[model samples]
Target: MGRVLSVNAREFEEWMQRSLAACEAALDGFVPIDAPVGLGVAMRYAVLDGGKRLRPLLVLATCEAVDGDREAAMRAACAVELIHAYSLVHDDMPCMDDDVLRRGKPTVHVQFGEAQAMLAGDAMQALAFDVLTPDSGVAPALQARLCALLARSAGHAGMAGGQAIDLASVGLSLDEATLRDMHRRKTGVLLQASVMMGAACAETPARATAALAEYGAALGLAFQVVDDILDVTQDSEVLGKTAGKDQDANKPTYVSLMGLEPARALAQELRCQAQQALADSGLPNTAWLSMLADMVVERDN
Candidate 1:
């Protein structure tokens, strides 16, 4: 527990640098020369930009817990990040959050035009698969499974569906149940995939996959809970994105529905549920997993 919070920022920086470097190297070799190269640059712009890399890190960590091959895990890790990056690119569009800042820099739509941001997201969606099924070299069945997991997480069953629900809820009175469904789709699905994909790399049993899925769901909701808490307490500089945007936009959130203290309590409970799910999976060596759960509950950003 002490070591998790004490993770050196320098080590995290180095790890991210290595991950981004490899992702770029793979893209550089495979991207078609006929394409204007601008697309690749935009892709780089979105991906190379700063982030916690939490989702991909989860993928890698879960894979290790399952005793899977690390190299194969990289492909899924990269895929999840691309999907995450693409979602952020679109999420910051003028039509969506319309924020001008992210990771302490201009949002993609602010730096590039909205059209470019949309295009970049489109390209990333395709490129994510380029990383997964082909580059990873999992068995055909596993590749199919990975692709399915990603599709559900990124598409209607996951992020897309969540965003749709959220957008619809704007300016409307929503209850706690409504908010939970919105988050479950928008954030929960991808997170569930992060753990599932890692297990997929190791060909984990159905039971383990189910357990990890539960962990991801609980963690995903917990992530939203923290985000809600941060919106009220944290500043833009610390958050690296617009804060209080939900309140400003009149969007429904846990803090708005449950109040500050209860929201925090719920987040803590969700984190514990997530941690317990992993423990019940019967996997070993959960140091990083515990760290991740702690970070989700305690993160300022």
Candidate 2:
């Protein structure tokens, strides 16, 4: 994989196109027949909004890295994306960030009313759990494990909790440890879960899973740090969301704690640290793991 992050390359372009196509196919019959037409439309928009498909891709990649049947991981892959889409939809709501744009298009709330947007997010979340339940050749035990891990990562104790901290910390001076805690739960858990789900199919050793989880933790935090830096340096067009959104929201960030230059440096350090974790865990011989770490820093948008 060589860890390249730009989308203009031929191989990456092909992968993204195929992934998005698969994602759309998985969403077929997603519309609820009795739901109001406006609400159904909102649901589709939220689930189908264009993105890098990074979470699902991570699932597929990690499954392959650990010698599992990559195809068997398909449903799990889509499940991750569905949950991610649901989170983005809710995050953009007026009750949340109130973001006006997502992936360069009007946010669900901007196109559909707030009530419809909320229903769409709820629907998307339901669909995510439904996808994971399908018999995709995943063992019953592994499926059950995946369900528990993903739920823990998504519900009140994980991403939801992290989001709560973020909302509460707005305009408040927070120490770095507190900020990291908020991000690790809110963002890192999902990333960790994605990798673990893939590894579960492989039935890798406990040590391997722990190693990958360490890598996941470092990369997830690095991803967030870079995002904060990009908000300070990039524009809305390139970012696809409103840039400086953290600042406008008066949210404390890595950039706020340290200078932009230092934040960038920290992200780079974390990326390297993540790669080292993979190596220390004996997965370093794998190119894709290291490549993903590099992409965390080199991604342009």
Each prediction's total of clashing residue pairs, residues at least 3 apart in sequence or on different chains, is 0, 1
Please state the error at residue 296 of candidate 2 in Å: 1.9
| Model 1 TM-score (2 dp) | 0.89
Error of 1 at 282 (Å): 1.2
TM-score versus the correct structure, for each prediction: 0.89, 0.90
**Candidate 2 lDDT over residue span 106-180, tens digit each:** 999889888888888898888777777766566677778778878888989888999999999999988899989
Query: CA lDDT of 60 in candidate 1?
Result: 76
Q: What is the lDDT of residue 276 in candidate 2?
A: 70
Model 1 C-alpha lDDT per residue in residues 23-100, reported as the tens digit of each score: 556545544334454666677778774687778878877876788867667777788888998999999998988888
RMSD of 2: 3.3
Which sections of candidate 2 miss by over 4 Å?
1-21, 28-36
Scored by lDDT, the top model is: 1
